[model samples]
Target chain A: MEIYRYSMYPLGLKKLIVPCRQLQAFLQDLLESTDHLKAVLVTDKDGVILAKATGPDLPDHVLEPAFSATFSVASDQSGKLGFGRNKMIMSTFDEDQVVQFNYSPLILTLLASSKANSGVLIAAGKDLEEPIKIVGESVSKAIQHEHKAKEYV
Target chain B: MLKPKVITQVLQQANTAGVHAALLLNPDGSLVSFAGGTEKDAKVLAAVASNVWFGYERYGKPPAANSVEGGEGKEGLRNLILDCEQGKLSITRTSRMLLCLVADERVEWGLLKAKTRTLKEYLEGPLNLVASY
Candidate 1:
């Protein structure tokens, strides 16, 4: 029975869950720390929103697909620029600022007020290193599980 | 209306400010003028700048909410900075064209921003002239 359970858990039972709650919680904490921040979004390369946290003034749907489009397009073109992989992109507008990070297999976008200190926001993004690592590992494991399961069937 | 002399002046100022290379490009990423960098890198920068600007315009800006008074989304894009492993790429929008700069690790972010502001001001007239042409 123990061996059977081990075979069933080939993908590692510990890492199977996507850790959606942890990501949401981290984003929520990040949002609360700064009023200047409007929203935080985590998405895959395909523009699928995996986790998000928004301020009271901003609605969840406010982001739509525009944020994803911005990051995806920039990242794709960035590679051709021969600067190696892009680390971060910061764009400032009239009233808002958008910062996108190339987390590989995942893209992290932060929407903030134009008035916010960009240095602080960039530091906040750097703080996500640990969480991003965990999330990346879990997501990779989930994908591996799906593939392995398909092979079994 | 635009003169090669004006582009040279701006590029010279940028080089003095510690930028390794710079390129002046149209919104579509066509090279208007280039200084310091290899031709291949300049072309790539122009293409990337255009794509990034297009993406920001089309998707990055959200629609203004009906209830959100005084909120507008039609404002012109100010600039874009991409921090990469190789170095930093800063693209600023002038009245008509894009100014792209590639700086090495020796350049500080604050210093770069300050220089970029001045470069943008210097390039505005010439870039606008290019647009008019």
Candidate 2:
């Protein structure tokens, strides 16, 4: 599948909500706070990368869609196990760890070294709750505006 | 093969420290030993852990990236933590087995992880013995 890379101005939301540049800055700040973090991605529910920041140590093949989609499925399935809603999923490998937050309408993913503290990353994801909700709401409004504009044409 | 008494002891030890249940399973999801839960619950957890692990392997694969050399890169998931409304679920790999801890809301993340790390270390020895057998 061909993935579409959007500019800092995404979804005709250029002037409507938080600009993509600001979103990128937010992600960059997260990357800078952690020493072992390699990359951070902010993607919509469909796995479209809205903003991203990368450190020098990132691997060549960090597929944005894979992380987004995997979290979606994993979280959805796991929720039915009587645990109620799934808030976060953290996977650790030998050399790397992936942490994803189940922020609806938006998924925040972090790529970090295996040695990085999971608790810190979990706290970071919690801290993102409000900002992500605001961004999600703004984008939804912008999308509604776009649909309305198309109807007149 | 691990003696039943040793497996029971391992599960018993894990039952402390706010861990409500503990399970030891093969990589294939077959339950080997379990504690603090019914047999049916153990089976269900084993299946869930296997499915979640497979989901990560199938969908979390990086695109066109070479495997990590001489590492367990091909071994799929090493550890997974699921934070939910009621509690936390931690699954860690040990040798060729998987150690799963089901903790209630009272369990803190640090305490749970520390318990998991210690259990993983302890399991390694018996697991190697089983492998040798």
Best by TM-score: 1
lDDT of 2 at A78: 77
Per-residue accuracy of model 1 over A118-141 as CA lDDT, tens digit each: 888888888886787678777787
**Per-residue lDDT of A35-95 in model 2, one digit per residue for the tens?**
6777788787678887788886555455533778888888887787677888888887767
TM-score against native, each model: 0.87, 0.81
Worst 10 residues of 2 chain A by lDDT: A1-10
In candidate 1, stretches whose alpha carbon ends up further than 4 angstroms from where it belongs are A1-18, B65-74
Instruction: Compute the lDDT of residue A85 as modeled in candidate 2.
Output: 88
Q: What is candidate 1's CAPRI-style docking category based on DockQ?
A: medium
Q: For model 2, what TM-score is found for chain B?
A: 0.82
Per DockQ, the best of the predicted structures is: 1
Per-model i-RMS:
2.4, 3.4
Share of true Cα-Cα contacts across chains kept by each model: 0.79, 0.64
